[model samples]
Target chain A: EADIYQTPRYLVIGTGKKITLECSQTMGHDKMYWYQQDPGMELHLIHYSYGVNSTEKGDLSSESTVSRIRTEHFPLTLESARPSHTSQYLCASSGTYNEQFFGPGTRLTVL
Target chain B: GESVGLHLPTLSVQEGDNSIINCAYSNSASDYFIWYKQESGKGPQFIIDIRSNMDKRQGQRVTVLLNKTVKHLSLQIAATQPGDSAVYFCAESRGFQKLVFGTGTRLLVSP
Candidate 1:
């Protein structure tokens, strides 16, 4: 089984509030990614990291920021949450191998 | 603009029947393709994958077909069961970098 985990499986907050989503993996992967997905919709790449201290923006523009402090941790932060930002955030990690393993996901709701 | 997409938004199949999900990608240079299954309120799980050089690959009751000439890919599940209900996604990658995920397809298996 994949050893990836995400904290706060679900979150609800008011608009303009700051929030952070945590992601970690025990598989010692070098590549980590964060994606935004709406209900039954396409997954939009928000942020990704190659390894510690390396981060890059994905194809879709997102207001959230992510940091890769250690090989096993990648966290995403939203400075000011909005109703539009409410969606499912999925964290994934992949090694040099072909497939990626995903976390259970965090459902964020900004009222 | 350039991305991977699913042809069907949803597919329903009776139990013990065979189901097929199709996907189209615009990047001809993509050398690897993967299929993923996502249950409700969870992130995607890797199902199977196929390389550009291969036209077909199978895992258990699942099969993946890759057609580079048409830039199309497909996933087939045999003896479908209720547990197979979920959203399916196809992703394409080149040079082993970030993967471009297709619009999801919801598979609803009926008993």
Candidate 2:
């Protein structure tokens, strides 16, 4: 089945540690996005990629960076994690203006 | 600075009852809108979508109503069930694939 996937569903790392969240989509979508969401709060876009080798920062300034090496893969990396960085990270992909499909999400906890 | 917001932060409804969630956007230029249902510890799932040219659209036991004049949107769930309990959010897209999401309304269904 064609779907989006995220690895490390839950992560607990110490502060200052480097961590990467992996996201992959099998639907061959060119547009991918990363969103940060606090528990029970609204999702805030952190990064997005329009196509291969393209990335942009979203409305909410983020300390993380993302890369799109392939159409199906978009990974986010935090050079130095902090406790404030602890939140759920969701990945999504879309083909056009239609609905977007989201990954299961990665819950990160920086202790 | 077009922001999307929800009318209610949370809603509680009995099982088998109808549930309604409302959203409002500040951008009239938005061309598309979507409703997403997100359960705890998971990502948002696409529920329904509506274009600016349309007023209403329906899906399995769900309906989405869009009003461009007032920049308002609504999602109605028929015969609400426990599985339907989640956070519902409305997203708006203008030209780019970037979707701006609303604050979200938590739906709690009681048996």
Candidate 3:
């Protein structure tokens, strides 16, 4: 099984609340990624980090920001969560071959 | 812009039969391809992968076929079981960079 983990498998909050979704991996992978997926829809990459202090935006535009201060941790934060930001946030880690191991996603609901 | 997509949004198969899910990518430059399985209320799990250099790769009861000529990729599952019912996604990446995930195909396996 993959060593990746995500906290608060489900979250519900009001609009304008600041929320942080936690992601961590024990695999010592240099590549970490965050993807947003709707129910039964395709996943869209929102943010990624090559290594510590290296972060980049992904194909989809997202209001969330990510920080990679440590190799094992890559957390995504939404400054002001809105209803549109409500979706499943998935965290993944990958090695050289690029086969990503994903964590059990965090499903967010902004009421 | 490059994108990956699936031909069928949903596939229905019977238990103990073979199942095939197809995907097409617009970017010919993508060198690595991977298949992922996502169950309801869970993150996507890595299933199998294939590099552009090879045409086929196999895992336990699962096979990945790549046809670079048509920029097509496929996942084959042998003796489909109830446990195999989930959403299957194909992702492509170029030079080990970020991946472009295709719209998933839901696999419904019935007894």
TM-score of each: 0.94, 0.94, 0.93
lDDT of 1 by residue, B34-85 (tens): 9999998989999999889899999999999998899999999999999999
> Can you write out model 3's per-residue Cα lDDT over B1-111, one digit (the tens) per residue?
123222438999999999999999979999999899999999998899888999999999999999999999999999999999999989999997878888889999999
State the TM-score for model 1: 0.94
Each candidate's lDDT (Cα)?
0.90, 0.90, 0.91
DockQ ranking from best candidate downward: 3, 1, 2
Residues A44-98, candidate 2: write the lDDT tens digits.
Answer: 8899999999999998888999999899999999999998898889999999665
Candidate 3 local lDDT, residue A79: 98
lDDT of 2 at B61: 100
Candidate 1 global CA lDDT score: 0.90
lDDT of 2 by residue, B13-90 (tens): 999999999999978899999999999999999899888889999999999998888889999999999999999989
- TM-score of the A chain in candidate 2: the value is 0.98
lDDT of 1 by residue, A37-67 (tens): 8777788888999989999999879899999
Chain B TM-score, all predictions listed: 0.91, 0.91, 0.92
lDDT (0-100) at residue A17 of candidate 3?
98
What stretches of model 2 exceed 4 Å from their correct place?
A: B1-8
Residue range A24-110, candidate 3, lDDT tens digits: 999999999999888877888999999999999998898899999999999999999998888899999998877898999999999
TM accuracy, model 2: 0.94
1 versus 2: better DockQ goes to: 1
The local lDDT score (0 to 100) that residue A88 gets in candidate 1 is 89
